[model samples]
Target: DAGVTQSPTHLIKTRGQQVTLRCSPISGHKSVSWYQQVLGQGPQFIFQYYEKEERGRGNFPDRFSARQFPNYSSELNVNALLLGDSALYLCASSLEQPRGNTIYFGEGSWLTVV
Candidate 1:
């Protein structure tokens, strides 16, 4: 089975623009989470979806949104982009089990705002 995959490994956008990033979870995984990582800091949680419904969200601004498809794939959308929004967007998938949700992350989509 393939690992989680994210699209547009890299991108460049100007301030005030909008961007969308896509992700496909590993087979059998039912939950997808999104995170943002600045160069030196750890990833900041953004959103999580399970069974195609939003399970949770972070303290991000209203401009950030995400959704999961029926097939478990997911997309992250950001509007009114700012230079501060330039970071690595990560996608992780987890199999919610009795033990715990074991999350696996993809390389991430690198977004650079001008």
Candidate 2:
């Protein structure tokens, strides 16, 4: 089965434009989570959706949000983005905990804010 996948391997935007990142989870999986990884820092959890329901949320500001689809795919939306938002946006999927040990990540959507 295909592993988790993310789109627009890289992106660049001004300080206020919104961006939507996509993710498709492994077959049969029903959970997807979003994370932001700044340069030299570990990935920080953003939002997690399982079975189309919000499962957990991290300390991210209101600008960060995400949703899971019926097919187990997901999308992350960041509004009124900031320069500090420049980072590697990672998407991870799992079969259980969502935050479980079996989680796997994508190559990430690298965003650069100018």
Top-scoring candidate (lDDT): 1
Q: How close is candidate 2 to the true structure, as a TM-score?
A: 0.95
Candidate 2 minimal-lDDT segment of 10 residues = 93-102
List candidate 1 stretches off by more than 4 Å.
Answer: 97-99
Model 2 off-target regions past 4 Å? none
What lDDT tens digits, residue by residue, belong to model 2 across residues 19-112?
9999998888788889999999999989888899998999989988888888989999999989999999999988866543588999999999
lDDT of 2 at 106: 91
Cα deviation of 10, candidate 1, in Å: 0.2
Point out the worst 10-residue segment of candidate 1 by lDDT.
93-102
lDDT per residue (tens digit) for residues 1-114 in model 1: 899999999999999999999999989899999999999999999999999999889999999999999999999999999999999999999986213757999999999999
Best candidate, TM-score: 1
RMSD of each candidate relative to the true structure: 1.5, 1.1
Clashing pairs in 2: none
